[model samples]
Target: MAMFSTGGFAQHGKSKKVKNAPVFSQVVYQGDDKVYNEHPLKAGEFYNPILQGCYPDPAITRKGDDYFLVCSSFAMFPGVPIFHSKDLVNWTQIGHVLDRTSQLKVHDTGISAGVYAPAIKYNPNNDTFYMITTQFAGDFGNIIVKTKDPFKGWSDPVKLNFEGIDPSIFFDDDGKAYVVHNDAPNRGEALYEGHRVIKIWEYDVENDQVIAGTDRIIVNGGVDLAKKPIWIEAPHLYKKDGRYYLMCAEGGTGGWHSEVIFVSDTPKGPYKPAPSNPILSQRYLNPDRANKVDWAGHADLVETPDGKYYGVFLAIRPNEKGRVNMGRETFILPVDWSGEFPVFENGLIPMEPKLNMPEGVENKTGKEGYFPNGNFTFTENFTSPQLDYRWIGLRGPREEFASVLKEGGLQITPFPVTIKEVKPTSTLFHRQQHNNFSFTTTLKYVPKSEKDLAGITCAQSERFNYVFGVTKKDKDFYLVLERTERGTSRVLASTKVELKEPIRLQVKGIGDDYEFSYSTGGDRFVRLGGIVSGDILSTNVAGGFTGCLLGLYATSANDILVE
Candidate 1:
């Protein structure tokens, strides 16, 4: 993570505006094992972990009957995922910010460095909602964009002259606006890669600049009570009952460490820790008898029309030994203000799909989209924009790398010809199904050569992937599954392919690894690979800042791999 060094951050230029604003989408999941995260969702209770997956450092804003939210996308394209909710309880994803490569310099970014915590604030004076995200780990500082409709048109990122991580926006009751960013630039040179201590600086919205008010380091190093290392970032502020609070996430982002809260007051001095400072840690949840787990934390707080407060945070989920492909998903927790300080209660508000009358949204589950007869399609180039909020990449989504129909059906091209390139180019994936589910899809391929290939993968990591594809050999093709676990394909089976047919693949995720079955007839599938990507590969075990990603992939030849 690059820290803010000298004075002015980011190269300044005329801020252009992006046209289409992102949308809100709903994700519906089905299968058996009806235990909302091994537990049930009870209302009016502080539901812990409102979301379960990779939705980190949530910064949200409410407008009328609609609610808008954004999350940190480390390396995924379309950097920030924008979501909308009518009643806060139910959310739908509409679209993503930075719909192109020009919005980012992804190659320069590494794990967890693309987009950080964003502050979403609607400026009345400007009559626009500004979304500020930290790119390049605050080296180039923040990217500020604005819109009249959250679903479209944000002014191109106006590279504000400031550097810091975890930027936030605040609209004072007196109408004075300010931007609070995280970084202690004045505290000396790059120590511990500038992640040592983070502070906040106020910015002037009118001039599209940083104003000189108080850029103080309010909260010092966070609660390091987890017997492990700790750091603080993602700062959000709101004034209530004549008191100011700077709410933030503490501890590291994984394991039993992640949690959210604030220094009970101030722009400067005497800020006390929330009574429930580490209120909602999955580590604090009833530990498993086996005693093994990890949870992520980064959150945003919102208040409903009736004045009820809810916190949107992150947590991980398990499907037997296998974990979710989409890690750090957003979960809803209520602010337990019953005590002197605010705390997030426990619960996993099931992410609903559009096809199922919005389960949990309509308060009904066991019916539509849950039955085997129910229809669910992932046909090549299939899309449902209104239902994509459920889809999340483990890290940052740079540029406009993906789309549902946003680019016309999950348009995936090549970044590199092979995984060996480091940036596996043509990959557009969705979260692995969480329950006892089955996955099937038909793919049409045009592999120019054995080097140019496309395949169906149940991938946990580069080392652990079950690839079923048609590799061209002279003028013919073969059905293959390569398990590159031991530095090469340990399981390599290539069958002759009928040139005129499409490959139909089916994956049954039963106990442990998904069973891969293939067919040329498109009627019945024959087992091709067994138990590919065995388990979730162990947390932090895989390099990328994500869980296993399951979907389609393609690669060009090495010569075309680099552009």
Candidate 2:
């Protein structure tokens, strides 16, 4: 176990002075799911969701034998989590692509308003990797960053001359580069609510800019304009056997989501949609089917070293209550590119829980340094100089408020900002990885006033969340539980307590019910608010692109009443 202590202090807007700051000793997360426990992995089978828990909008690329994959991070600091895989089955998080505050400017934005649909591709012409995405906040619309070696560091963002989201770069075989993205129809060409178009521009490789006059519409209104398709985004241009292929995600990111393909003779194309249409989808399947996986789309394809093609896409697995709390996850499926256009092998049908591993590749997941799937447990002691990549902050970088104490443990300097505000708060967040899980942390501190509080926060966004912590009310110390749903906050429970030693706080989720508990000295914990509904922590109810976040939170502007 590690220990922490605070020495220096400062005052900020509307915050009161405090004597002792809160110190966190450790955090442990354990996943216990009935489905995963019953259905164990066989000899040659692996899990379907290679990268689980809120890792959405996957884009993949390969250079020689190495494959690099990236996912959308929204407003989480150090945006665009990147992963490395030798075999498509096993993956390891190398680090984030945007790891600096100068490169990521989402400081005052909402949790779900920063980065959207990041596309990563390798351009062999210059031996560099390009990551392009739209920053909905910070006024940095459609930016691109380059890195010669992804293991090192990335360049500062260069704003692109585009007006839309999901921008992707493609380097043709003849050394010419082109950029394709999702944009709205020209001026007044709107046919329906979700009517969108795919546009292409000739990119200048030397100047890193798209030619101003070379922009044109590639696929208008998706597969068939007559049907008026919705959200034709995440476009990628690929060339094989003297033909240019264009792929995109259609139908919104909801139940009707799917992947469609188009073909043309040139990069700038009057592209033709494939006759088979939806190359990948789970929309038409039975809703109550076993091991349900829905909302599958936003796919990127890559050819493995052995010439076998596979696609990394985003999908969701709802709980028994038919609610999505874990958010969209990264899933891999073998692609059958031997046909005219690439099609996800088992994509159209009801998705299975396991997939057959590639030839001669052993499943080293949950062992080695590879990312873990299925049921697993993660514990952090906060003793090392560098924090693990799994721990991240919201809106701003974690280093701005968190420090690993010289003597050990982690110290979070409380900010005046609370979790209810859109600004960055003094909180370190980790994604809620499982529906049935437990998160526990031990804290050592005593509140000086009612304005100070430190504990755990289970947040879906600023408007929908739960805060449970220790606060000073009147002349006594108390533990309080507050619930915020759709912007309305109310204290669910509160109890006076004596602060003589470190206290253990925990939150457990069993299906749609969530319970908060605490312990003072021993392992026995008393439940604080009984079982509360987790409906607000779900995307279906919270209305956002992100999943729930488990935050080690501390704030000087605490407002939960203890009456």
For candidate 1, write residues 1-563 as lDDT tens digits.
01111111112111222222111121223333334344444442222233334556677888776788887777655467676667564455656665445564454444445777777877666577888888874345677877899875466677876666778887776777666556653545433432434466666766777766556666556544333235666777777766667766666666544555555444553466675556666565444523123464667777777777877766665556635544565666557665565676542222222111222354212123211111233323233332233333323231223334333333334444454333524555555534355656665554556565666655555455566666677777766766555335444456767746556666666535567777777477788645555453324444455555565655555221111
For residue 422, what is the lDDT in candidate 2?
Answer: 92
Candidate number with greatest lDDT: 2
Cα TM-score per model: 0.76, 0.96
lDDT of 2: 0.89
Give me the displacement of residue 50 in model 2, in angstroms: 0.9
lDDT of each: 0.54, 0.89
TM-score, model 2 to reference: 0.96
- Across residues 289-329, which tens digit of lDDT does each residue of candidate 2 receive? 99899999999999987888999999998989999999999
